[model samples]
Target: MTFPSGGRVPEPYGQSSGANLADILERVLDKGLVIAGDIRINLLDIELLTIKLRLIVASVDKAKEMGIDWWETDPALSSRAHRDELARENAELRAHLAELERGRGQEDPSLERGRVSEEPS
Candidate 1:
């Protein structure tokens, strides 16, 4: 097919004689039932289908992916998971600080100076 910009676009399914455009496309995409893509697929005994479409619409940041441990693990789908995690972590840290405050008789001026944890050696 030709675009208005004079670009030749490769049609996925050809314009057919007997079948309509949708019908031809559906036959190739749905009924023809061929699996070919970047992602992996594992079918057990050929009874059930397991289609893995690796659609990287945009570039993803890996560090964020590693930090959260979601999208790969954690089956629970939550839109506010990252915010929830931050809230939970903040709560835990507050609790710890409270404990520390309780442990020491005097208030720690150093602790209040905005200390962030460094990775353990």
Candidate 2:
């Protein structure tokens, strides 16, 4: 396909039509594949932000062999840890809310009266 910029882009599925799909899959799964790219945002010749993205495609066993299994231990991905963290956070927020309510409840009426007395009658 020809782009507006006159650059020729190959078809998505046609690229591997001549090659053996099984051979490509075996090679990729065995050695793994790393696709990396950088995205930049520029405003009026000034670079505002830059983002780097990296992706790895491999079999589950291969990925684990590479020591890249963070999802296994991530609290959000683990049911027990997720529930524990949520419960702890909920208890803390409840405690903080109770403390604030207690402080408001203990407010001195004399302080309000003093402020009222200082105002013009």
Which prediction has the highest lDDT against the true structure?
2
lDDT of 1 by residue, 50-91 (tens): 555643222124324435345633335555776677788899
Which candidate's TM-score is highest? 2
For each candidate in turn, the TM-score is: 0.29, 0.47
lDDT of 2: 0.88
The residue pairs that clash in candidate 1, if any, are: none
* Cα RMSDs, all models: 15.9, 12.8
Which regions in candidate 2 have their CA more than 4 angstroms from the true location?
1-19, 75-121
